[model samples]
Target: MITEPARGSTVTQTIDNDTADMSDVEAGAFADYVPSSELQKVLTEAVSLLGGSERPGQVAMAAAVEQSLRSDGKLAVQAGTGTGKSLGYLLPALLYCLHEDARVVISTATLALQNQIITKDAPLAVEAVKNVTDSELRVEVLKGWQNYVCLHKLNGGYEGSEDDLFSTMEDSLAPGAGGGGEAASGRGTKTARQMRGFAAETKKLYEWARETTTGDRDEAPRGISARAWRQVSLSSLECVGEKCPFRSECFQVSARDKAAQAQVVVTNHAMIGLEAAGKQNPLPPCEAIIVDEAHELDERVRSQASTEFSANMLATCAKAAGNLGVSGSEELSQQAIMLGVALQNLEDSRLTQMPEAVAECRTLALPPLKAALTELSAKSGSDAGSDGEKHADAAKTAVAKAALTSLLDTLETMTPESVANGETILWLSRGRDGDQEPRLYTAPLDVAGKLANRLWSEHAIIATSATLKLGGTFAPLIHKMGLQLEEPQPETLDVGSPFRHDRQGILYLARDLPAPTRGEHPEVFWDRLVELVEASGGGALGLFSSRKMAERAGEVLRERTDLSIMVQGEDSMAALVNDMREDTSACLMGTLSLWQGVDLPGNTCRLVLIDRIPFPVPSDPVIEARCAAVKRAGGSDFMEVSLTHAALLLAQGTGRLLRSAADRGVVAVLDSRLATARYGGFLRASLPPLWPTEDAQVVLDALRRLHQKVS
Candidate 1:
């Protein structure tokens, strides 16, 4: 650890010192030693490869490798952009893996980062390690099933043909229909004509891909479509695992097998969450895990755990159940009645205000659920027909049982404990359109305590992100993770970016603007947004806090600008980004999805406009309970919990700007609170250190200069 000269600071530490020709440090204690001159040479090579100068993040990571290895304790590093963080952690983990002959799992926040590591950084880092020493180490990328195309689905074709579905699917798969099959020009720019011309070529290539067995899409980035990917992707509910006929040829399994043999495994956040949640534990217990772009983990976990019931899902399940034609059909119908009865009881207008009936249903729900599971178990075991037919019947019955059981369990969990400090609320919501079936939503009062207990209790963990520490401390966020220690010894480090933020970037706010009511000032907001986009000559990304707002704002802007506008729901996220990149003057208006994973550098994106700070939905059961819990604990929920979450998201949203040192952009926050509220300082502190400006002309001038340079 090197210390800079300041008012009263004096420190003695080695920056880069070669300790020895070859040495072995304890797997957990590697961070204790200063990098010898020999190690410095290795660091220099990595830095050069990544096109970054040595910075605090790099230095801290080198040190953390030693500390995280030696103590086997957790470390939270806040490495900003342009810090070469990917290499900062990767290089150290690589060295530790080689020395200890142990495997390392590196989890990142996005597929883009995972792909970059597998395709670019890991290969180069492997070579860098080899240059430093002749040690041989293997590295591989691991992703979920959806990342690869299902050859069976593409070639063997699916069952049923209601809407010329097979023909439509085939045509889409055919090189250029843009129907949602894989594309050769994964760049997402191929027009319909070009796609058609290339369909045959893509089919031939896909056939070859099936035989190769790597099945990892990162190996071939462009051939898979969003639709095809959905069919192949596996969630906890859908993965038949060993039961799938394709088990032997399973791409997910094959990827895990490769990872099992490799010293370093590159993967994404959700997969890591799955492992941490004890869902996907495929690889050998890793000795160390490096998290790149660690800031996005919480949101990723929330999304992965979120469950929404819809009419489509209900109707599909019902039809699939109905398709079982059997003598026991009446009994099956009765079992379905249990679900309907429970929902109907809650909906009865006469019982709607009755507290006792609602309480009784909540109380008796668990027993019926258990009985249903037992009955369903017996039915599944009884053979209905041929082996395949029986299997299908059993699967359908089991799915129904599981869904019902989950509903009951969720409800049970949502009930507040007597004498509990906080309240738990239940919400019933109907699907879109008047006729869609209604659904129930149940959420726990708080997830932080549960998250911390699950992640930190039994395992040696490291949680790193660009904005983990807000207001110069991490207590609030750490508490949310359920870390409870008087003095949690988790190592904390910040790698501030090397970007010329003070000179190249500015933060603009509509402070004088009135707060936006739910339905008011939308037009005014859109008008201001259009003016900013025009002044910047397009090349902007508009981030809305909600999907409704994003769509509404997008609609308003579309009529006002000649620049192409791509909204989130209109197309796949990948397609939108690809389009945004291709059109220099295009404006991509999207909800929170564009906030973090997006990466557009240089003049391709010079302005980022945000509609508001993304606060969690107020009606959200989990968030509401968490806030209430904080209040019950005699703390301000807004300051302790809600604000912390918002600050982290705000940091992520603003992070879209200035991706690299050479990148320059204006980050415009339409939310005036960012410029007016007292807690605004906390949010501002969380952002990348940038010059603050309220003058619109100054921002316009900077955009003009950037536009001129690009032109």
Candidate 2:
């Protein structure tokens, strides 16, 4: 095979390669699905139609899900990469919703996964079910109401900053622009060229929203920023549902209505947590719940259940009340300013305890605002007018009411008793820039009890992910997730991956390098990494420990090598991934999100470089508090929390190497801790059974041979 170096990226490979072969895998002990059963036939047909091979691990996971539905059993299963886990659980979900007369809800981690299930997997699964059962299936995808475009907010129905609403996307996204982090201080902004570019881009969004079937942000065309999208989007606080003039054409309402009739509803983890935590009930009732990408469930739940109090939100509240023509708004506005001042002072001082100024603001400043909002909410749109006018007025009032209610909830979380009881943690979380006003945050330190009450009690529950077991066991995840807090605990199963990891992948630990230290210079890391990427001919996905490391590596590589190099946040994530796929020699370097969801199978990705172990920040309040609590309860804080978290992330990072059974690659861990530390054994056990090697020459030789074959 003839290979060439990338023009600037120094990547040494050509773009052409063969498509990955994904065939059916051998069945294991999980073959006990009722033969000739409606569920079985539909699943069989769906696999056949997917134009891929069946995997035993997939079948095993599906059987677990189906059985849980058949009985009332709860299940926790781990299906590794290339196991076709999505279809494994989805086919049964569809069969149950259609054949067994059950309602099923599938919640995932990211919006992309939600769409993939609803748009790609669900359609194929439905067709397969139709073929076998001769039944029409109803599947709907639902996100939070805020995820949809609010007709009122888009058309200047709100009372605040509509004239300059999107004057500068930079201002809107600036530290304090919309009143969240810092007051929109108009500090540093962009060029006239950039603003013109933004104007054209946002105009495209307006046109697309009118013509597009789904007004969801994911459906938007390329180059549209979040700041631009938020102009057309709605939050619960800003929406007046059922009162807007364009309710008939509302994307959010339509989606919810469709979900009401759907037998199967696909959503993400955050929406499910909100539905359970809040009384509003965003979704219809479901008899069965299936959570995919179950690894991130804890973090999503924490975020959904938490709320932050900031000056910007307070400013919005005051404006919403004044729009109702409230008489007391003059005093309320003054109090809102005081509240903002108190917040700024509290954050600036960096004190842990609640200050007197903040307490007074909450007591004296907040009550009048609440009263004004309530009065307006109670009599909103009462002035006699045409139906259209009244509807718009009511929508505005709804927006005010939503904000008022949310503020009260935020207040409750920050109250002394709530913070003292240990059920919730109230702390001041600073911004990326220390000078920004610190927002008061209230988050659940643990959601176990809440899940026990609202989640574990479901009729049937199935949780599956590529990396669920913390360290060779499901006990940690199950216990922490509150999956076993109720009667009839879930049955645990491990459906191993179909890929021959032992032969197809290598775990190359760079023992010659020194351990990664926070303050130490990383010249050694760059030297080893650049050499490895050159040897592999540029099919590498580099996962770094921090943004600084990623930047240094990216800069050094781009300056020294001729390979195509892409860094995170430099462009939209979608564009970077597309460029990498098109330019095979390109090396995509980033942290976090890229670890798991990225899929560049076969020759396009043959090398993965992990800068270091992904341990939680030592200063993170939440993780530190949890670890302390575990230590107090007679558990090893390092083992139960720190090591466990790092192990799961390492498994996820390493799993990126061999995405298909036919794919062969190497995962190089630049950190020497995996070889020197004692707990390394546990982490290694949690990963796939990749062949181990320490010699750089061995890996370089293997990469060359694989690169030749692909060429």
Candidate 3:
């Protein structure tokens, strides 16, 4: 572990927060205006209100965060489950924003946590602050523009010709419509069924927009299904900001206004990545940042930095031509047809499969498409004055122009060699459900350098997550985040889990089981799973390595056992979890996603079955390339990257077992490698300190006892 430079003065260690000795905070306390005692007072009151006694770990985290933000230094905190990490970070962040009259941004990895912070934690903290300091603290949540309702799209979409929008093009060179079927163009068939479904969904969205207090797509009755939502929402490429009649009530603008006025802004990781990458956005600038799920930061940044161009874009260009009714419409339409056909044919020749071919397509088709777009642009210009009750024809033309120009700009950047480079991940993916050509994609091989340059260097960042350190060291994360091991290094602390893991959890490795060969779950494994579930009496969460394994096990379990088996995709995620919680005898099985962000306390999940070690697919181009780079740098990619990744996942999967003090369970790793393989000890260190056992009967008996006690 790399130690930070010594502060001029030491943090006075003392007993504070009434019940706990916050040694972690006092270890390197902030030398700022607010005293540690004062900070602790506010945090203690907030914790009491949020329904927990004072936790030493939480207090220490709050102090470390306060020090980093006020001093403009970076800090990495690993606050384990039951540490009350959210309130610890938020209370201090809110107070700092209020004191300095500056905005502080809090970023999470998902919408669920973003909403939770704004709706649940933020409000409580605001009230807590008011109670303690008699001051007001305001918070607002911000998402990307596309997440909001676009009144322009709502009013202008389908205005030109509903029939034309879904018509099958007659051009033989174009990639014909797939109509959402299993065909060459999966979404080629844009027929009545497709059109009607879109119309119905849009109508509902339109009605909701008028009445909704918050025009967030995630809040709609029907969640934002990409295909359905795209019909009514506008990407930045399609939006004519502040130009339409609905400008005053524009959801995006209003959301931005609210965020600007806020002292503390709650947002997702994507927004942070975008801002760091130098993309202009509506989110407020911050004095300090608190990244809650910081472990995923580098990956999220890489994903955001990635840009792709697909053939479905040709449809947008073609629609723009039809909508404008311009003089060059015929020429633009022909170019669109030619480009789509060329892209699809190139893909068929395995252009993306081989790196060399992806580079060549740039020479063959890119220049011609750009020339056609320039000619089309010269033929038509925006009509600013446009209004209508039935159809916004003039506005449609302006939008079409914007969409076409954007497409042209995107394709212009992908050079043949640049598209197929060691630093880029290139692939071929089919376009959306419609008459669309497959898209050629190139994303960054890794985000470490970009994030290190863009985010960590500029802001006083507070990176916090339960699983930031694999095997209890922040070295991997620090390196990946582009931080150094030398002086001025980020301060670090690992406030361990508050739960009594030694008593509350049991670690059972099924050593008798065979090795997982070629990532396949054997029939014997399924039989053992059945036996375990039967013994546990169905408070089991069967987490598998693949969807096929989950589905197969689910089917066999349903046939072999009488317990209600709920599998993912069988119903909505929320619905399935709710159903499982409502019934104690229900066993829910799913893939990788279930490993984290699950909160099934008490008897909802008394046993967790890990079918195999969670490792990245060896064939994934990105992973392979990342490993190659590590090896070239004189590092063991398997240990640093692969082992670390699997360990973090195992830690996350096991963390689900002991969610609360009252919760107790068995984390059974069915693969024998975790017990027999050389890497088993390293992996075991990632999990909680549970009572280890190898006897199958011992685990079965314990499960039976737990089930009996719960019942």
Candidate 4:
């Protein structure tokens, strides 16, 4: 694995060499080859059929993608919103798959984008390519095993320990005296009610499983809990492979088979992360990878690689072992109690060093846990019995083995050697309520090494996102992704947005407002915010740094203005965005999620209000450790970790203003730091090059005029 350079280090590489002036002999080589004419024709046709006109930026991106794929080099393209980025990459990918007879995997950050590509964009690209090459392309969606319903579990072939636990409780409560007694008052009544709900949900899932051919949980009835889904689905670890009687009809197996036959496979980042971690290869082999929303790849990979342990998890493992008839199960339960007690004695914070309590728990629990896992692993699926009985036994043993293996892994991660070497960072966290039990979490200090050795080294990569470049360069994100260590360093391109940013929008920095402090913003900030919203006639999207600020802004605005005000937590984000789109004069206030993927065009959104710079909390475990690492490496942690994060989010929040060529609005930043800080220029360069001004009146006048025209 390639070790990453120090954070904020300047690692530069030249752009892809222009082939226009090269001789035919030199350019004919794969490295210097230009995009084929066929690529342009297919892309043009795809755009035309999608009801869009030609975009220079999209064409440029497509050409770069084609060159990268043909030469087997890494490329990072920042195709701004409305530049038709999806089609730009999809067209080249489809063409490559058809002509080369090779496969390509397209990984996205969200399921919504996956669905959009599979249902809408992929079909259009296929049709466009078919029209040109007279050949067809096949696309498939591949997800984790847990996403599909396991016929073995749904068909009553596997009764897990959870069912046994519930049964024990019901039997224990069965001896209650006549109806309407103490049994109907408190705990008993609540248990009965919960049991009914669980049964109802499980029954519904069974019915749906019979009717739905795909067996995907995403297609199941809405409002199903994760607990209910677990009853019918199997994790990768819980699958019994060929031992299951339902293997012939398993949805997950069928999906994998389909992916093997597909020319293009669409999956999420988590699946890629799992593969990169050497956990499992859920996807088939592919020649190239296209990571859309590539900015989110690092964090998603980190989340998948991270693991947590709690008393409840230990209890679950103990129950599974007990159900599997393993020895030492009782000792495991005792160790769980001891561990819970030790956790309660410690506070919730990042552990700079290993705690004695944790070490003691590990030393005591390791033996029993290992012994149970050994016995469970020794159990065989091939026993002298009926096929039905053997199938059920195999499934139950798989679940027990998986649970014990996960518990053992968590214990191994807590070793002092792992924590002391700086390979991992450990922390303790809990639920929102104080009474909730604390859980221990351990994550890799850096995922760059893993990603370098596993992903970039193995495939030709084309990573694209609107916000990949930070502080006017792609070096920061590239270095973070470990792409800088690749043999032929990735080429970077910025196909600017199709929208005329300077003509259609204004970046309003509130220079006169007081510098924001820790707690609440000054009343003057609220006053200025109201002024901007009123100027835009209430067509405003407020992106705050925290939920408290967003909710407070919503409350104050509803009282101060006559227009409609919708808070994010008031309803579902989809419903809230739809309402904001339908009601022209309504103002929507939200944090984090609203910064990206909230697309409202034309009159529905005339202004955007940013409360302050969205910076990562310094006390966060991962952020804190990363900053210390940079500091130790003689680098500026603020620049490498904090400022870059803020810039990306600020850019995303700013981009929410313009969704189309016709969009016209003002992005109003209430914080004065953007104009006063020394790093202000760098942050400004990260954003769209809008017509900028420090005066609030200039923005107000522009908004009022735009609002008047729309009205």
TM-score of each: 0.75, 0.89, 0.85, 0.89
Per-residue C-alpha lDDT of model 3 across residues 258-330, encoded as one tens digit per residue: 9899998888889878875666667777788888988878788777766655444555555556555544445
lDDT of 2 by residue, 1-711 (tens): 112222222121111123332333456456564433666677789888987656667777777788888787789999888787888887888877766677888999977788888789889988998888788789898888767777666676664534221222233433544442333333323345677887898898888877777777777887887767766776665566556777798888889889989989998888778865754667788898888988888878888888777655666666666777764556656766876677665543223356677676666655676677668766764767987677667666666677667776777667655555555666675566664455777777778777778877865888889888876888888877789797777898888877666557777878888998886447877888888888887888989878887887788889879998888889888888888888778899999878878888767889999999998885676776677668878999888888888988898889888777667788999988887788877888788877676767777777776767756
Candidate 4, lDDT over the whole model: 0.82
Error of 2 at 59 (Å): 1.9
Clashes of each: 21, 14, 10, 0
lDDT of each: 0.61, 0.74, 0.71, 0.82
Q: What 10-residue stretch in candidate 2 is worst by lDDT?
A: 8-17
How do the residues 331-428 of candidate 1 rate in per-residue lDDT, one tens digit apiece?
A: 33444445444555454111112245334444544455455556665666675587565445544554455455444445455453521434333455
How many clashing pairs in candidate 3?
10
RMSD of each: 9.8, 5.8, 7.3, 8.1
The lDDT-based order of candidates, best leading, equals 4, 2, 3, 1
What shift in Å separates residue 327 of candidate 1 from its native position after superposition? Answer: 12
Q: Indicate which candidate wins on lDDT.
A: 4
Return the TM-score for candidate 1, rounded to 2 decimals. Answer: 0.75
Write down the lDDT that model 1 would get. Answer: 0.61
Candidate 4 lDDT, 1-711, residue by residue in tens: 112222222211000111112111112222332457999789778977978776777777888999888888899999887877888898999988888898999999977788889899889989999998898999999998899998888777777434322112223322343357664677577878988998998888778988889999889996677878887887787788888887898899999999999999999999888877778677999999999999888888888888887766676677877877887678778877987888888888888777787777778778988998788777854485888778878877887777777778778867877777667889887654543557789888888778889889888899999898888999888887888889888998887777666667778888889999999999999999999999889889999999999999999998899999999999888889999999999999999999987889878987999999888999999999889889989999999999998998999999998887677788998988898888887898899877677767667777777777778
